[model samples]
Target: MGEIDTERQKLNCFRMRELGATVVPVKSGSRTLKDAVNEALRDWVTNIRTTHYIIGSAVGPHPFPDIVRDLQSVIGNEARAQMLNQTSGEFGHPTFTNGPGRLPDLVVACVGGGSNAIGMFNAFLEDKEVRIIGVEAGGEHGPWLPDGSDTDKHSATLTKGTVGVLHGSRTYLLQSPDGQIKETHSISAGLDYPGVGPQHASLKACGRVEYVFATDQQALDAMRTVSRKEGIVPALEPSHALHQTMEFAKSLPKDKIVLVNLCGRGDKDMLHVAKARGVVIDTDVKLNKTDFAQQ
Candidate 1:
């Protein structure tokens, strides 16, 4: 991961290390997702025989994206099965159905590299009645430009990027007219990227899936909403999806069901969220005798 994300996402990195994985922090360029991916690709090519590049998201070249989507498809498979198996008493009897009975009117997920969204959408792709939506991070920008000219303030690749090649894949990318990759921003560390997966580009081109963006403030608000109302603290990545899901749900009838993929937990994002919201956490505060005694 990049140096910035390595620090912001320290808990996950530490957990990976505890599980016997070597976490390499790339300290070059913008020190963000794009730079990290570039470094990983460089290392993989140099030590092809000794290293296996297991990409976490559904980005990169052909086979890798396919592999990731296939592996992560378990999410969609399980969701679809659970939704369709109302007869088996899972999810109980639904108030509405997809003609065939008990299917989501909408399937939504947050799209950084699009692994999770692709995984969830794969199972429902054949179901033409299912409306699939992918949400991207809008950063601090209130709304993204249609032509992708404003690249620095948002990671809304599918929403605002131009078609270009990045990380060995032809996809929508935040780049300059000279084809140089541009910097992207998002409150969510995981969704800060310049390019999306090739499959997502194809989906966008074919109009099979709808791609939208949620602003940083909207996502933060949604995170708090879900945390307080549903007792589920979602990671910043999935909060974008939840924000869009809430907006989309309002237009639907009472019987319709919208499914949003909560792909990560908020445990890894607590500090980042606090800092973004201007809440200072004094980690260096000296413990009093009472504090030690409570522990």
Candidate 2:
């Protein structure tokens, strides 16, 4: 899901490599997804004839974003149908069918290249009663970064970004006065973008959707909460949405329903989360004997 810099998936990485996957490790500019994209773009240009770039996000250009939204729209459609048909069965989970059984009061998803958010929000545009909230990855909050820069350390584009052209599209971006792309930070590699999809910017300007941010700490805390409460370790990206959903839930009554897109699981983020909590992983024997041990 994310945690690209953790280097903890040694066995899986080796397996992928043995399957002929080229693992070009990115080693610059925060060593996150943004830098990995830069490297990928650089490599794509080297041999355009033999390579076709299939982006993971919905932020690139006009038709590409539309294509992704169309494909991912299935997510919203399925969620809608599932919620509509949810009923309390003797053996299945209980369904709170006290009021209207169709559609939730609120829909929440994290914004990483705006794919999941756009996908979920597209189906609820006409439903005026349903609230759409997009959560951005809010990284470490402090006085600038380690380099003493004067920008936020989080990748909160719609909340902290302005209009600009980036990644072959005009949208909201985080940039310097010289128009240089500033580095973005997030515990989740999926959200390490300095820019967002243009449609999200339009949604923000038209006030059709509300955008918020959840810090790394908040997302991590939410991740643990869901893990313990629901027995699901969510990816850091969706953890942002989960964190915001908790905040939004506090204002509403207990009966009000909120649908959170738990997009990806946390199978890929254990090492990153462990490192964040001051635990070291020694799968590769990189640490001392007294430090970290592999089970």
Among all candidates shown, the one with the greatest lDDT: 1
The stretch of ten residues in a row with the least summed lDDT in candidate 2 is 88-97
Model 1 over residues 16-89: C-alpha lDDT tens digits? Answer: 99999888888998798899999999999999999888798999987999999999997887788767764344
User: Positional deviation of 140 in candidate 2, in angstroms?
Assistant: 1.3
| Residue 166 lDDT, candidate 1, scale 0-100 | 93
Using alpha carbons, what is the TM-score of model 2?
Answer: 0.83
Candidate 2 local lDDT, 1-295, one digit each (tens): 1235536444445667889986777887766666766667677779899986666678775677888888888788667656766444322224534435578999999998899888888878889999999999878862255686755688988888878887678988888877888878888877778888888889899998999988899999999999999998998889999999999999999988999999988877787788889998776655676675643
RMSD of candidates 1 onward, in order: 4.2, 6.1
TM-score of each: 0.89, 0.83
* Candidates' C-alpha lDDT: 0.89, 0.80
